[model samples]
Target: MNLLVICKASTQIGFGHLIRSRTFVENAIEGNMNLDITLCIIGDSSLKLLLKNPAITFLFYEDENQILLTKSYDAIIFDTINFNKSVFDKIRFNAKKIISLSPVFNLMPFVDICFNRTQYWAEDIEKLTLKKYGGFEYALIQRNCNRIHSIIYKYGLEKRYFNIAISMGGGDAANKTLEVIKQIKNIIEPFTFWIMLGEGYSHSFDEIVNEIRKVKKHEIILAKTNHSMWNVLSNTSLLITTSGITSYEAAYAGLPTITFYDYDNQWFLLKELVDTKLTINGGKFSDNSINNLRNILTDLYHDRSVLYDMHKRSKKQFDNEAANRIINIIKEEVFKT
Candidate 1:
């Protein structure tokens, strides 16, 4: 079967959508499904990372203005946040079946399947005609096929400063990484800081290195897009991440995380996750917020039981089989349709 994946990427749209789409395809291939796949990415020049894989063809469009496909695909999956009118119009008439990821309001009544995980759609979705699959059971967590590692839940509290991880998503669009790193300088914590810098991060790597110079043991990890985080996440005792798929992925890895958002779109959902006691909410990047964060960290340092409880809850929330379930949907529903 010939399949086309239409998703958003680049430093502009952020990497969550594209990462999940990539994970979906990786899972499909790992399952040994017989298929020909082409990923049509709508992003800027930073999107060349999608082309490194020979198994899938990559078509990078600078904008969402116009997209063309050579052949009508068996099924096309749309994982973008914005509903492109032109792209939708073309896919509606061209593709045999159309499916979407999350935030389904825009594509409702026009898609065959609405696979939603965050439930970001504000409209009355129950009234929509399409089949909706909602819950974290469908959240896509990208892992490198070669370095894929399972989440082994940690049973006890941390002893402080053993292994720390910092992953601020694919790009620090809001420059939150710099602020977070600067604040880390004030904290009295001691540990080996493993900072993962996204490929799209506009800031210089030297900036982070200089800030954490006081630490005796630390490493700056620069990961290309779609790179596996297993190596770093495997030994991580504590993690600081942007509220997105990584936080969800960290959950499945049995790693506790402190989640914050520098973007407005991630605020509501992240706040909800915090209120539900999923991950530690560090709030926004601010003096007051950082002070609040400092207090949280201090409390956690004194009593590691908090991290243990958070770890247990996160693993329960993230169902790692989301990608596999997506493929089954295509085989059973899309094929029959």
Candidate 2:
């Protein structure tokens, strides 16, 4: 089977979509060795570093149009949030079937299969075609999820400081990392902050380092790499992050999280995550958010039960084999005899 996987990643939009698409393709190939895959990412060449499959062909965003105009694929899987009707029409002309992942587009009628792990569109599920699937059972977790289990046990050993991890996605277009760090400085308690920076982070590292120096009462560790965040979250007592792939990963790792929505679409998914009772919603990113997060943090710090309850709920909700399930479903649906 010939498959075309499309997604986007950039410093402005972050890498969630690309990460999901890449993981999906990896899983798909592992499950079916005969499949020929071409991964088209709507971003620059730097984004190629995230994908490691030499067998799959990589195409930049600019070349997508020409590729679509020429060759055809057996199926096209779109993992991007940016859905354009015109582009969808173009893609349809070059593909036999269409499948969408993660955030759903309004143009669902044109899609043959859609998978949204969150309950954002639960109300519309019954009204859709038989191929539509939703809920955490279909969540596409990173491949490194299994590795974190042992790490979590290793880090579960006693520690002195309350470790809080702040990861605001790759781009952090709104620069919420600095704001979150600054507000946490107000807490007089003994806490250590781990700031996970992504490749797309365009903010001045020097500025964040200078801000870290100002905190005398607490310790701050700034992680500036594409390192496995699971390791960091394994040791972390609390997570301060945007409602993205990272939040779900933390949930699967049984780590409590305080989430903020950086984008408009994130707001809907955030609501569903809050419904799971695994995370506390910190609302949208804004000027007033600093004080709000600080207050939430202080409350969780005092009430250990709240965090522990969330931790327990997480283990009950998330499954590491969701990616395998999704891949199996795709093969069953698209490759039916």
Clash count for each candidate, listed in order shown: 0, 0
lDDT of 1 by residue, 1-337 (tens): 7778888876755787887788788777777567777888888866776446677778888777768766788788898767777668866766777888755336666888878666454345667777777666876766642211324334223444556677777776766666766666555655455677677777776776676674443344434334646665666667788877777677666677788766565565565457657678877756777667666666777777677676666655775678778778777876683
Per-residue CA lDDT of model 2 for 1-337, tens digit only, reads 7888888778887898988887777767776777788888887788877777786687787534444546887778888766667767866868777888855555666778888777666344447774777778777777765423434533542344778889899888878898887788877766788999888899998889888888888899988757476766677788888888878877887887888875674576777679888788888887787688877876766676777667767887877666567667767776788
Off by over 4 Å in 2: 63-66, 122-131, 147-158, 263-265
User: What's the CA error at residue 174 for candidate 1, in Å?
Assistant: 1.2
TM-score of each: 0.83, 0.88
Flag clash pairs in model 1. Answer: none
TM-score of 1: 0.83
Question: lDDT value for candidate 2?
Answer: 0.76
